[model samples]
Target chain A: MSFTLRFGPVFEAWRELAAGVWLTLQLSASAMLIGLLVAVVCAWAKVFGPRWSGWIVNVYVEVIRNTPFLVQIFFIFFGLPAAGIRLSPDVAALAALVVNVGAYATEIIRAGIQSIHTGQIEAGLALGLRPVQVFRLVIIKPALRAVYPALTSQFILLMLSSSVVSAISADDLTSVANNIQSRTFTSFEVYIVVTLIYLVLSLAFAGAFRAIDRRVFSYPVAR
Target chain B: MTRFPSRRALAGLALSAALAVGLSARPAAAQTVDEIKKKGVLNVGMLVDFPPFGITSLDGKPDGFDADIAKELAKSLGVRANIVPVTGPNRIPYLLTGQVDVLVASLAVTPERAKQVAFSDPYAGIRIVVYGKVGAAVKEPADLKKFAVGVARASTQDVSLSAIAPEGTNIRRFDDDASAVQALLSGQVDVIGAATPVVGEIEKIAPKGAFDTKITLREQVHGIALRPGQDDLMKAVNAFVAQQAASGALNTTFRKWLNTDLPELKKPAI
Candidate 1:
C-alpha cells in the first residue's frame, strides 16, 4: 500500500520540538561532564589506588554494566523515592545517565590507563617529577589521548540514550514527538522528522568532539 | 476546529437527511453503503491493542466489545465483517481516506472528533472513576482536596479531574494508566483516576474492596463512525445501535469481555 507523506503539522509544532531538543542537550551535556569525572576517578582507583578502593570501584562497575539503562532510570526516578530520596525528572535523568555512562566509561578509560608503559612512568619519575605530577603529566594525558575516540563515541551514545528519560516524563525529543503524533494522527510523518533531527544531533555532537580533541590534545610526543 | 465543523455539519446533516428521503439520486459522496453492499463485505476498522474493547485473539482475528459490535453491524448490513486493524493514531485517517468502510474503533464521541466523521448514537462506553484505599474517605471530587490523586497525564481522566479539582488538591500526572495505578497500589498516591478496564485488572490482585470507586470523574461514549455526509449509512448504523442496546446484545458483549454490565450511555450533544 502506498502511504502519503505529511510534514506540515510536524513543522508547525517546531516550538515544542525545539524545547524538547534543548532539554535533551542539557541533560546529556551535564551527564557527560559529571560522568567523565566519575570515570576518571574510578579508573584511577582501579589501576593504582589501594586494593580496597579498586574492589569498591569493581563492584560499582559490574552492577551498572550488568543492568539496562531503562531499569537504571526507573530505579532512580521511581524506585529511589520510596527510600526517602525524592528527585525531580531532570535530576533523575542526569543521575541515571551519569551512573550508566560512568560504569561503561570506567572500563574504557581503565583500558587506556593500562596501555601506559612502565618505561614512561620511570622516565617521569627520574626527571624529578613528584608522584602526582608523574601520574598527571605522564599517565593521564596520553592515556586519554589514546582512548579519546572511543570515549567520544560513548558520549554520543549517551546523548541518544537520553531519549529513554521520556518514560519518566522528562520531556525529551522522543516524548515531544509522541505527544505531537498523537495529537496530529500523523505518526509516520512526525517520526520521520524526529529521526532526521536525531541524526543531525548525533552528527553535530561527533563534529564538536572532533574539534575539542584536535584543540586540547595537540601536544607533540616522541614516537 | 473539529468542534466547529461538527456544529456546522449537524445543520447540513439535517437538510441532507431530509433531501435524501424522497430523492432517487443520492449524493455522490454519500454512497459508501451501496459500494459495500455491492462488494458484499464490510471493512470495519478497529484497534487491536486496546484490550477489553479491542484486541487480537490467538486465532488472529480481532476480538472484544468493538469487534463484536463491528461483526453485528455487518450482519445487519447483510455482509461478512472484514476486520481491518487500525491503531488509535491512524483510525480516523483510515476511515476518512477510505481505507476502511466504517470504524467501530471504540472511538469516543467528542466535538473535536465529530468534525471529522459522522457518529452513530452512543452504543457502549467507559468512565474515568476516582478510586482508592477504603479509608481514604474520598467520596466525591470535593473530598479529594485532602488527598493526592494520580492520573495518566493528558488522558481523559486528567482533563476531567483537572477541570474540577479544588485549588489545593494534589493531582499527580503519570505517563500512563499503569504507572498511575502503580502509584496508587504503592501508597504513593491516595487515589487514582482510572478507567474501568484498569480497575478490573487491579481487582484481580487486590483484596476484595481494598479500593473502590469514590466518584466518577467523567464518562466517554464510544460511537461507530462513518465518513461524513454518509446519511444513509449513518441512519443504518444508528438503527443498529438502537437495536443492540434494546436487545441487550451490547450489554451481553460488555459482560462477556469486561465482566461488568454496560455503562449507562446516551447520545452526547457535542
Candidate 2:
C-alpha cells in the first residue's frame, strides 16, 4: 500500500497547536513552582515537625505517589464535582499536576533533609541564627541543592505527563493535536509533529533547570 | 550541566521514530468476493460496544443490527459469517488492512472516509441530536451559548455542533461517547450531542424523565465498507443492500434492535 504523508493540514492549524503549547507551558510552569512550595512545606513537616503532621504528610505523599496520574486528574475533574467542588478543565489539570508532583518532590526533598547532620542545625544556632533562618539558610538550601537534579527530572516528567490532562478535555498540546487529527485524518503527521514539540518542550525545560542549578546551587559550602 | 540531547531526549526521539515506522507500514491487500468464497467465511467486522447497531449478546456472540446485516451479507455470499468485534476508531484500519474482508461496522458514509475505502449504499440510519437535562431551555444551537455542551471530540456530532454553535458556546469535547454521556449524567455539562441509540442507552441508565432530546443535529447513514478499488466486492455489497431494502428484511432487523421502523436509507453524496 502506498501512503503519502501530508503535513499541510498540521501546519495549517499552527494557531491551535501554538495555543496548546502555551496552555501546556502555563500548566507545567505554574505546577512546578507551586508544587515545589508544597513539597518544601511537606518535607519540613515530615522530617522535623510534630508526629501527627508527619503522619498526615506521609498519607498525602503515599496516596498521590502510588495512584496513577490519570486517575488523580479524573478524580479532581470528574469525581470531585459529585462532592460539590467543580473545577474547569484547565484549573483541574493544574491542580492535579500540583498535587501529584508535590508528593514525589516531598519524598525527594525529605531524603535530602535526612542527609543533613543534626550537628549542622546546632552549629547554625551556636552562630546566633534563629530557627526559621537556620532552617531556610542552612538546612533547606543545602538539602535542595543535594536533591536539585532529582527534583528537576521529576518536574520534566510532570511536564510530559501533562499530556494526559487532555483526557478531561484540557486543551493541552495533545488534545489540540487530537482535534486536528480528527478533522484532517492525518494521524501520522499530527502525532509526529506533537512528538517533536514535546521533545523540544522537555529539552527547553531541562535547559532551564540546568541554568537554575548553576545560578542557585553553585555556592561554595563550608566544610 | 548535562550534555545537549540528554538520554531522555534521545529516548523520546527513538520512540517517535519507532511510532512513525509502525504507522507508515501498511500491509493492506485487496480482497475479492472470490477470495472470501475460497475461504468459506466472510470476515465481517462490527462494533461490539455500539448497542442496537452493534453489541455483544448475552451468549457472548456478536449480535446487533450491524451483526444481523453482516450475517445476511455472508449468507447471500454462501459463506459462514465470522463476526470480528471492532471499535469505532479502529474499524476502518481493520477493513483497510484486510484484517476483515469487509466492515459491516456502523461506519457512517462521509466524503472524508471515501478516500480510504469504498462504501456500499447505506443500510442503516441514525439521528444525531442535542440531548439535555429536562429543565434546560435549549431549543436550538443559538441557545447553546447559555449551556455547557459535551461531545465526543472529532465525532460527526462534534463537527455538526461546532458548525452550528453560537460564538461563546462552551463545548466540552471528551475522548468518546461514554465520557460525554458521563459528563451529562454527572451534571458536568448541561447538554450533550449524541446519537439516538446512545440517548436510548442513556435513558436506560439515567433516571426516567431526567433528560430528553432537545434538537436534532443531523441524520447519518451507515454503509458497509471495503478497501478501495474492490469494484466487484462493492457491486455485490450494494446489490445485497438493495435486495434487503426492497424485500423489507432490513426493516425487520432495524425494528427488532431499535424498537422503531428503520429510517429511510439513501446513498449519501460523496
Q: Which ten contiguous residues of candidate 2 chain B have the minimum total lDDT?
A: B23-32
The residue pairs that clash in candidate 1, if any, are none
Q: Which candidate should be chosen as best, given DockQ against the real structure? A: 2
Candidate 1 reference-contact recovery: 0.16
State the lDDT of candidate 2 residue by residue for B189-266, as single tens digits. Answer: 999999999999999999999998899989999999888888898899999999999999999999999999988788
Candidate 2: stretches off by over 4 Å: A221-223, B1-49, B54-104, B239-253
What does candidate 1's lDDT look like per residue over B1-270, in tens digits? 354567778989998988878363322222456877888888889978567788889999899888999999999998999899986556876787677888898777877677667899988889878888998997667888999788765556766788788887877656666667766776667888887787877888788988988888778988898887778898889889999889988899889998888878987897
Per-residue error at A173 for model 1, in Å?
2.5
**How far out, in Å, is residue A113 in model 1?**
1.9
State the DockQ of every prediction: 0.13, 0.54
